[model samples]
Target: MLRLSRLTDYATAALGWMAERPERIVSVADIAQALHLEAATVAKVLRALVQAGVVESFRGATGGYRLSRPPAQINLVTIVEALEGPLGMTDCAAGAACEHALHCGVSAPWQRISAVVAATLSRMSLADLARPVAQRRHKEIA
Candidate 1:
């Protein structure tokens, strides 16, 4: 089955929360407490986010993290790539050294599928996810 890692899931949850209040600088501890996740895990995720240019890191007193850009500019593709490197449905699709890539008939199809998946993810932004699930469900119902 296709699945993202736990860290990627945590990344989405953490970024979604921060996106709700983009102006506020948040600590890992605060995010962990607010999201009911482990602080250590959140810290690692935030560090990766900072390196990915998704979040800005601050130092010294009152130091924390803040969104590097508006939530609308931060798409899921960027987030996924940040945590998981590249988005690849298959090893060959990700540019891995597959010995059979030259002769593999499925390589083209997998690459196409990967592109479609990436395009879909690129369309979704952190702002879209920042909304509370209940509100989104209510809107869907309406």
Candidate 2:
């Protein structure tokens, strides 16, 4: 099944936490406690996200982490790619040339499907995720 890794899930959670308070710099410990996650794991995930430019780290007592850009500017595709590399629906669909590349009919179709899935993910921005659940609930009720 297509799914994000635990690290990816944590990265998204961390970013979503920051998005909730875009102006505040949240320390790793605080975030871990709030999210009920392990600090070490969150730290590792944050480091990866930092390298991806998804988050910016600060130093000093008041230093912590914050989103590098507006939520609207980020997307699931970029975040997932940052945490897990490219999204692929099949093993051979992962940009690696196969010996049966020319003889395979299923690989081509799978590749096309993967492309569509990736494109759909690319079209959804983090802003969509940042929408408060209460707001979504209200919309649903309406």
Highest TM-score model number: 1
How many pairs in model 2 have backbone atoms within 3 A of each other, for residues 3 or more apart or on separate chains, i.e. clashes?
0
lDDT of the structure predicted as candidate 1: 0.91
Q: What is the C-alpha lDDT of each candidate?
A: 0.91, 0.84
| Cα RMSDs, all models | 3.0, 3.1
Give one digit per residue, the lDDT tens place, for model 1 in 1-142.
8999999999999998898789999998899999999999999999999999999999988999999999989999999999998888998888888988778899999999999999999999888877675377569999
Worst 10 residues of 1 by lDDT: 129-138
Q: What is the TM-score of each candidate against the true structure?
A: 0.92, 0.86
Clash pairs detected, candidate 1: none
What is the alpha-carbon RMSD of candidate 1 to the true structure?
A: 3.0
- Candidate 1 residues lying further than 4 Å off, grouped into runs, are 132-142
